[model samples]
Target: MPDDKTALVISAHSADFVWRGGGAIALHRAMGYAVTVVCLSYGERGESAKLWKQDGMTLEKVKTARRTEAENAAAELGVTDIRFFDVGDYPLDLGPDTRDRMVDVIREVQPRWMMTHSKWDPYNTDHMNTMRFTLDCRMVAQAWGHNPGQKVLGAPQLYLFEPHQTEQMGWTPDVFLDITEVWDRKWAAIQCMQGQEHLWSYYRNVAENRANHLRRNSGGQAGGRAAKYAEGFQTVFPRTVDALE
Candidate 1:
């Protein structure tokens, strides 16, 4: 509903977007871009360790808590829309229906840019599987023959946000977004992920480390910008431009 200026984030789990790209979401939203996040699953089975440790936590209870957390996080991040597929995680899959649904969302949003998981994640196959499904669904959305009446999607830049373990995940950052101004918002969103309390400080540290990288690469030690918080991303496709910035 925000014209052609929209961004889509295809996350494997409810909290994946928060940990990996909350700053990017908040930053873009502040720049007048409508950010929409899609969570493939609640991450109940694998990622909700805190909730599971409770005295008696049912499957539905875990799902509800995860959903509420995600919604609260999205609001804090200034997200325009947050969709939950609720397909379940652990070993995330993209069945025919799910694939079609993703394609539909792509067409509907007609995003100018998109973000998703890395191509590989040894620690969590669900993260890798999400990348596969995102690419597959994007292809379907681009094909005019798939759905005659629907509009075909344009080639949008897909950026892979930082994973928990970038070393093993083989993710290299080509862009570092200075999110100091919106750091508080990102922190608030991070707090909404109560199920992963242990990661709160971990991700905050990641942001600070990325800010250091931003400062160094931006101007070196002598003239480096003073960015206190930042988010890193790896571009999945080559960026084309007529002139260098």
Candidate 2:
């Protein structure tokens, strides 16, 4: 645990973090938080259709390409500690070993907050499964009995980032973050995902739309905070506050 602020992102796939939480990651980094991203898989088997279309492509090659793209994106987002679990994809292998590894990371980071996928995603079970797995890891990390003499994790707010087809996923944003200052950084990171080029514009549109929502919620035309770009999140737990403003 460092002396400064810290946060963690548990991404189901290598590029998931970039698409979903890049702006938040960049904005927090600017605010002096050491953001650690953990990619459970490269999404090579399921999400590498474009790479597979290319001739002479192999599993390792796809994984390598995806990893490189993730690294590039993470760098653009100012994330220096991006980790890849290499557990495999299509259906992530979230076994005992993976759980233990994730628990260890949770304990090590002791993040003030965490981010992951939505609770439900029928389109991609991997995404939903990852969210559940992350929750389990968080719980284990907080248990003193899990690892004797190891530092236990503190309670951290878990924010569920926006998912594709938000309505279908049953995801409603309770928090809208104005990431106008870091939109350019997020855009640069989004460009690094060459494998999923089709989604570049889609996510950009998401940011813009979310920004509109932010503006409306802030105060509408009556002295609303102007935000050009933003990100939305659904909190899994209730927030404790001294007073409701």
Candidate 3:
């Protein structure tokens, strides 16, 4: 096993991590993993509909509000580090500069595992694009020629979190994490995303449903673990294990 107990989460929007991977973040933190979150954009333009409805709302003000909410949510999840790229949303600027920055962060963190959005999300191309961008950065970070003096990153498992419309996204989860113990922390983090109140209940329902999946997959009624809340993930790479237990 790797000596460093660290994990990274790359989120397209500020509040995306809270809704999608908050439970994992909290649970990992509780297990002594330092979880770092990177928010590529504030989601000010596209996702802050509730804030936009209020009077005197400018782009900067909206971004600030979203940032605050993200920070508060990260605190609730016990995140070790939270970074904001501040790159524009709607169509994220996943240019060479941003790619280099991400690669640098990947090298610096040297995470044991990583998490991001699903591979496909037609409704929100930003979500899909972020996953691609993450893959690109991960590859570059592992290239020895990219940055000679810097330490090359080792292969880390990239887990794709459940999307909003799973049916449309073509995402199939192979891993179900039981977050029952950290449900309260995840719920508190979810509440911090005040700008997107509409999604609060929807994600709660998703967690409950995933918990049922966890129980069924573990063994159904005979000897299944009763999980009250859970999160699902589809891994991009095959996991190497020594034993099949």
Candidate 4:
């Protein structure tokens, strides 16, 4: 971790951060890192069976419910800011300007670490595109580090969070965060996304699975890995090796 750093997450949909990396966000916040979330879409097309259970809920009503849920989830994780791009929700489309816009945001934030979806997630097309596009923007932004007129930024550590289909997505973890202390808060964060009925049980199971991973890695250490819960990440470009790599 960098000194007094800010951590940012660019999620493909509003519910992604809560479902996948909520513990990581909570851990960062507990450690005093300023956390921000950039949700590429409002996730209107996402699962909303729970929220839609009410009588005669229109699309506008669903949108309102999801927005509130996302806001509440961020608050639970102690996030400082959450920005929604309101981009189309079905699947993330990184056309052309999306990449540039993400680059600009990265330069502005210049965070010490960034988290987002993995590139091979088949569960959601938008997540894969978000992963691909964000990585693309990350490289382009770093390449222009010294160029005049571009926001200056030393490349930040990038971590890929699990997608909806971790097993199917071929997610391999190389980093684990023991979010034991903030596990309750992580649960609280995920519970905020009440719109996604399909997620509640699934994410809780994911949490337990990752917790087991931590336990195995820690060799039953008191707290280091034996912690009851955690989040795992697969990193790209682990360290800066050259001016241009």
Candidate 5:
């Protein structure tokens, strides 16, 4: 574990951080990385069965509940800095304005690595927009493009997390992290969703399936992969991870 590693996870919605990359977040925290999560929205419109079912569930109530859920979930992963950006919920607009906001955040954080969805996804408009924002943010940082009013930031290494539906979306992961050691933490973190039981089960199964693939593909890392889970990621551009001593 690195003593002073900083990680930033930028998610389209609150649950994406938990359901998709929970293990990675948890493992990073456990390994002593300072994990910061940027949740674009509270997921009020697209999904909120649990809170909606409650009597007299207002928008404020849903926002509060989701915020608490995110806090608890991220806490499980030892993450302490949570930026709950009050962006739109589901079916988010990835217009130029949103791109500007993303660029500003990138400039402020100046993170070494940024993870978002692959630009190839089709079903989820929000996912596609997220990729656009990430790419645009990079271009703005590198001064390859203009993001008026946003300070310039250095280009960061970029990564694309695996899409939940790999086949339908045609996601191909070139890198997979053996998160076997952190699977339980991932599961526990996801339980905070509290809004969807069936959805949680589906994600859990996905994690298991990814683990199976890891065992077969880990090669030398295969020794510790049995009965473990993993996460896959796709990269858009070449990355240079500086070796720090």
Candidate 6:
């Protein structure tokens, strides 16, 4: 681990982090890790239907609403730092300065591990594009020759959180995290996303379902640990261990 135990999460939209990795953020924060979340965009254009449906809704107003919700959610999850790029969505393009800024964050945090969306998403190009840009920035941050004086990053495993529709997104989870203790915190964070009210109970159901999987995979024998709520993740890089349990 670095001098400071840190972890980074890159989200395509303002609320993506909460819906996808809120449990992980809370669980890790409770474990003495500083979790930093970077929201690439507010998702105002594409994902803010509820806000847009209201009368006399402007872009700035929607953005403000989205930012407020994310900030509250981040607090609920005990996030150490939360940054917003304020980049427009619905084809979320990385502005010229955005990539360098992201590199700066990666260098600053020096996270031991990172999290983001899956490699592909049929329904949302923004999700996949964000993943691509995150990986690209990570590669740049890891190269000592690129920035010279700036701190270069070490090898950090990137965990892809569950997509909205995992079956259609080709996401297969290999890691199941038991977030039973922090489930309440995650639920509070999920509630912060009032813009996406429809997904509240949906994600709760997902946690319950993943807990079942966690229970079965944790050697479903007599007296196995019971996980009441869990979150699943897919590791992008193969982990190296000295010995098997």
Best by lDDT: 2
All candidates' lDDT scores? 0.93, 0.96, 0.95, 0.81, 0.75, 0.93
Q: Which pairs clash (backbone N, Cα, C closer than 3 Å) in model 3?
A: none
lDDT of 2 by residue, 1-245 (tens): 47349999999999999989999999999999999999999999999899999999999999999999999999999999999999999899999999999999988898999999999999999999999999999999999899889899888999999999999999999999999999999999999999999999999999999999999999999978899999999999889999996
Candidate 3 local distance difference test against the native? 0.95
Identify the runs in model 4 with alpha carbons over 4 angstroms from their true place.
Answer: 1-4, 52-55, 145-147, 221-224, 240-245
Candidate 3 wrongly placed segments (more than 4 Å): 1-3
User: Quick one: how many clashes does candidate 4 have?
Assistant: 1
The list of candidate 5 runs beyond 4 A from truth reads 1-4, 144-152, 220-227, 239-245
**lDDT tens digits, residues 1-245, model 3?**
23489899999999999989999999999999988899999999999999999999899999999999999999999985999999999999999999999999999889999999999999999999999999999999999999799999999999999999899999999999999999999999999999999999999999999999999999999888899999999999998999997
After best superposition, candidate 2 residue 89: deviation in angstroms? Answer: 0.4
**Candidate 2 Cα outliers beyond 4 Å, as residue runs:** 1-4
TM-score of every candidate relative to the true structure: 0.98, 0.99, 0.98, 0.88, 0.85, 0.97
Worst 10 contiguous positions by lDDT, candidate 3: 1-10
Mark the 10 consecutive residues where model 1 has the least summed lDDT. 1-10
Tell how far residue 225 is off in model 5, in angstroms.
4.3
Q: Which lDDT tens digits does candidate 5 get at residues 52-165?
A: 888988998888888898899888877888888768766776677776776666666666667877666676777768777777767876673565565566656677887767
| Pairwise TM-score winner, candidates 1 and 6 | 1
How well does candidate 6 score on lDDT at residue 23? 95
Model 2 clashing-pair count:
0
Candidate 2, 30: how far from true, in Å?
A: 0.2
